[model samples]
Target: MVQAALQYERQRRGLGGVFLDEIARIERHVSDAPGLYQLVEAPIRRATLRRFPFGLFYLEELDRIVVLACLDLRRDPQMIGVTVARR
Candidate 1:
């Protein structure tokens, strides 16, 4: 996520701020109630960014939520699965 924001910063003056705002929006949604998000797979839920082409993947546990990945939507889904599987 930081890498994408840095790239946006390099490309434009204030675009990175836009990304941050979207991230904050997503964060608020999660922090308010993690279980509010829709499930993506069997055990994972996904929260999408409002403006940017990114999504946050997470898993809710008994006591805490685990953030699995912050993915740039431009990447292939299969590649993303491979990347996430290793972790």
Candidate 2:
């Protein structure tokens, strides 16, 4: 996520902050409504970031959400799935 922010920051000033703010907003949504998203894999659910091509993969447990990965949507679907599964 730092890498992404850096890349965005390089592209334009304050863009990285914008990206991070969007991430925080989506994270809060996930925290507020754990089951609001659909499952991406057997036990993993995905919450897509607004205005960006990234997605947050997580596992909804009995008491908390375990974040698996923050991945780029532009990558190969199989690769993203594998990355999230490994985490």
**Candidate 2 stretches greater than 4 Å from native:** none
Q: Write candidate 2's Cα lDDT for 1-87 as tens digits.
A: 999999999999999999999999989999999899878887899999989999999999999988888989999999998898777
Q: Using Cα atoms with residue i matched to residue i, what is each candidate's TM-score against the true structure?
A: 0.84, 0.97
lDDT of 1: 0.81
lDDT per residue (tens digit) for residues 7-72 in model 1: 999999899988988887887788779888868775888788877888888888888778888898
Structural RMSD, model 2: 0.7
Backbone-clash count (model 1): 0
Top-lDDT candidate index: 2
